[model samples]
Target: MHPPAHGADTPLFIVLNAASGRRDTDAVRTAIESACNAAGRRCRIFLVDGPGKLQPFAREAVERARAGGGVVVAAGGDGTINAVAQATLGSGCAFGVLPQGTFNYFSRTHGIPAETEAALQVLLTEPPRAVQVGLVNDKVFLVNASLGLYARLLEERETFKRDYGRSRITALGAAVVTMLRGGHRSWRLRLAWRGQERDLRTRSLFVGNNALQLHQVGIADADAPEEGQLAAIAVKPGRWWSLPGLLVQGALGRLGHADDILSFPFASMTVKPAASGQRRIKVATDGELNWLAMPLLFRVAPEPLWLIKPAVAPELEAARE
Candidate 1:
């Protein structure tokens, strides 16, 4: 589908996840309303009750946007954004974000401001640009997908947040405790791409759609997913003690220089259990967890999603090339 044109007259339907991040729903609603008023645009905010409500609300918003030829904004974190984006996939309705989540990775990767007011201003002023999306089976993900250790970490982190309150410190503490408990295990898988197959054992497998994230993790320097391929990084099995060193390398953007990491680009790939009887595996996509039937299919969508980005942002300007 062609990119939808956005303007001052374009109606904005924002779906806000009340439980996202640290910001309360009322404050977010106030900020969005204020910004829309200042920009002289008509806006509607839908405060979602929970994760279960996001999909139906987002779908309705997309339907309305398509009928009115406007934009549907996901005003929460990556998970919320992914839910809204899934609805806009082929509708040709522009997708926007307010970036009210912790990391705001999708927003940061796209050059959308992390601050509420600034992000709203950008959405008001910028035109929508078409950006590629990655898919695992029928689900859409904007950032990355992973299996094994990273998935386990996310599960642990969520539980910790639910019990102790959510914060970066708590997340780090959860990671430390979870790692110490020693739950990670190696997986033997057969990876197939371009008619070739190889059997390998790895602690984790990451498939990234955001080129910036890949580069930051020292995996690749891809500027866009428009190349119609996903960047895959494999962490080979290693001693448990080496996990800390691997984490440091990733943080320092030197993961590519490490011996246990393997990185490559692929248009499509299949991951299956090396053993014949194994048929299901847990996968985390853009921080949301799910179980998928194996051999899992990973591929780039044939069409790109239209994203509203700032007209002039430093990160976006650098990515344009």
Candidate 2:
């Protein structure tokens, strides 16, 4: 393996989101400080109040790193990490994550520990490796992006969390309630994949950048994030009663066997309204929702981002071979 691009002299800039998840900010900050101190790494932590400040703070960190060649660590959930990672793109700054999210899918996919201290240790000592990033329109996502039903589910999940509380159980409940409430809606989509164009009606379209999630959900058997491809799954419109069976298949890692689920790999694709004159569509990238102009362009970024991973990451081992 190549030596890490940054060394002891390279300062560590941690951009933390104070409102991420339900973790106590003071406790997380203390843990980060303790871990960095124990690792003998010189670090500076910047805490932001909300998403509004995350991007600006991350951009500043990137500028600092570009001047001196350092690591910029995002110390929050996937949203926080996505903001920082997007800023670090093309800047040649090593991106690190201190997982403080409910899923931490991005961090876990790269073999970073969920615990603050252990993840810090990896951030302080490990080398940054190149990892593929997924792009929808102009936004970059480290995990997955989707349209239709999955997007609605994410939106409902957030609403549930805001009104009730955040937890895995609550998320599951939200999914169930969302489905029961007849939230799944079919889209007449014109999809261009692998140079082939097709018109299809589907309830959900998921493009996964994190191979681990694809495998875990049984959408794909191979975890090949470094292979320069995105794993995509589309669900055919079906009766509401069929949703549970599909869910079961996913949970059992057999989603590929389900008739309604279509799985494929693609370097890029175009998704837009099949009907004429429709100029906008809603997309959820890494659980953040937005309405983008029609004919959404999704692609694997031309250049991979340099992401910090644990020295002993199993994913890294797999990538090496």
lDDT of each: 0.84, 0.83
Model 2 segments more than 4 A misplaced: 1-4, 311-321
Candidate 1 residue lDDT tens string, 93-177: 8899999887787888778988888888888988898787999987898998899988898888999989988677887788777
TM for every model, in the order presented, reads 0.93, 0.93
lDDT of 2 by residue, 125-155 (tens): 7778888899999789889999888898999
Find the 10 residues in a row with the least total lDDT in model 2. 312-321
In model 1, the clashing pairs are: none
lDDT of 2: 0.83
Model 1 misses residue 285 by how many Å? 0.7
In model 2, pairs of residues that clash are none
lDDT of 1 at 41: 89
